[model samples]
Target: MVWDDFAINNLAIYLLDKPNKDRKVALFVKGCDSRGVVRMLQDNQIKRENIYLIGIPCPGLKDPKTAARGYYKDAGSVPEAKKCEECRHPNPVLYDEILGTPVEEPQEKDRFAEVNELEKKSVDERYAYWTAQADKCLRCFACRNVCPACSCPDCMFDCTKPRWLDKEVSTEQNQFFHMIRVWHVADRCIECGECERVCPAGLPLMQLNRKLIKDINELFGPFEAGLDLEQRPPLTHYETGDPEELM
Candidate 1:
């Protein structure tokens, strides 16, 4: 099936549960989804020989909420999703077969532009800004559920034994929840932006992810997770020349 704006679900996450490991399967993938597949392959979560990948270049999906607001004259004129606008990879990075002619990758934009602006503010200002955003969170976990990078068998939030977080939805608790989740996925997040899209609270979750990505890039010398199957994540590997700021 051809993926369009309506097909926003990340198929890579579903394919992780291979009922019959020996049975081969094939699925269509967009630029971001293909990266997630490669990531699973790198982690040995899925076998490359067990599946066929059909890659397709993405022109970008439109925001359904924006479309519902009568923002476009026609469906074809709908504005591109904010995440797609900042996407550096519109063409699939890995595939067994390509569905159509590859499109040229868009020029790299300031992906961390918003993050940089927030950093210019005072510590208290930044804290207040994030606190306000966190207060609106419903704790629905839709963001966590939709993220392809969050493949943890037992997410901390759902663990009742240790009860990492109390059931109360206070501002402090909310912020703590979000911060911990972001840090956990900092090294592996592919920036698919699915978390933000699925958030019922309309929180700008991508801003937080982009902030971590920007910091990691600056400190670790420009690493992009899931791009190379052989490459180790910055957090998982160490180098003698690595920055000592964290120390």
Candidate 2:
């Protein structure tokens, strides 16, 4: 079988499309890629029985862009990709077969350090911070294209029927888009960091994602999305004990 490096997001995506729906497929997955698979399965976008998974223990990848620019003279000196530095799962969570020795998971660090710091800011300060990020947006939609959770057949932003959003690229419009996008995947985000990595604006999209994730955990008990097959996202299901304010 032919094998080559492929973008994890691309492979994990398209599984939701009609072309792949009926086929029995085998997928090679890293930690992030495996999470995407779990996301699709939990969303009922793909059937687990039709697929085989080969897991790889990821040691994190070097930043190709920086390496190509000769940011480091030696391979060993190249820093790990920013996304991988914060990765909680270095070994695939679900796989039919695994290859290579399982790498030791990184020491648990506070994943929400940035989010917690931002929470200490006043409401106006938070708004100003987000506004600045929105102003830098090019509206290229690269983040959405690479997102595994955004597998809708017809995206609302692209619809012409109601003309929900215009082509205007103002800061206001950009903020609207970003907020809507984040909220849509807030509960289901796999923490793959593809959105921030692919963004041309270099926006800290993960901050927004993690902020929501933090809030969800606090409100509904500690939970991680796409990690368990049986546990549903807290936001997706209703519990009688859930906060009355939520209703």
Candidate 3:
């Protein structure tokens, strides 16, 4: 079947021109979404003064449109979102309120297993595979838009001056957009698997994210990006005698 624009976790920002007293304004943040929200709270961009947080237990939510019958047939009963595969934190560590029953931390799947196998393959094989996927690019920015961490009003691709990409189908341009965008969000990415779901090209985008998540875990320690508002992200923190970052 062809990919409809809404087939994935296609983000649609419902705009309200005027405020509504009866309407509740809340972001349906997944566990990872809460983390970025906590991070912003830590940074003081948003005030907790006029907000209502509705937290849900996520064994993981999938794109019902794209999820194959056997893969993710039931809510919270699926193979797992790629982010959940390596998820170090599953439940809310901090919240004023929560919804649904309390969820236990999930037994993590081996997130790096695929990346390790890919690494075993020769560089040429990896390049060929990635190029084939990248060549199918339609420049859909749905991946970035659906991500909770990617709530940016403007993205680099939206810029025109000295345009970073050709805006045309080309292996080089597509690869550059994918690689650069990944790197840009690497430190901040919550491994939510939103990108892979939104990819019209069906690129295994989670692999790139999982690799970074694994490296961060190994280098900095088992870090959960936005678990605690009081604590600093491992990437932004430093400790002496850390040898991993040197490698």
lDDT of 1 by residue, 169-225 (tens): 989999999999899889889988889987888999989998888888988878887
Displacement of the residue 77 alpha carbon in candidate 1, Å: 2.9
List runs of model 3 lying over 4 Å from the truth: 1-24, 39-45, 67-88, 234-247
Tens-digit lDDT string for candidate 3 (25-105): 564444665665675555444555534555655564445644554654455454444455556565545456787776777
**Could you tally the backbone clashes for each prediction?**
0, 0, 0
Q: What lDDT would candidate 3 get against the real structure?
A: 0.62
- TM-scores, all models, native as reference: 0.92, 0.92, 0.74
Name every residue pair that clashes in candidate 2.
Answer: none
Question: In candidate 1, what residue range of length 10 has the lowest lDDT sum?
Answer: 1-10
Candidate 2's C-alpha runs over 4 A off are 1-10, 244-247
lDDT ranking of the models: 1, 2, 3
Model 3 lDDT, residue 146, Cα: 66
Itemize residue pairs with steric clashes in candidate 1.
none
Q: Name the TM-score of candidate 3.
A: 0.74
C-alpha lDDT (0 to 100) for residue 24 of candidate 3: 47
Against the true structure, candidate 2 reaches a TM-score of 0.92
Candidate 3, residue 7: the lDDT equals 26
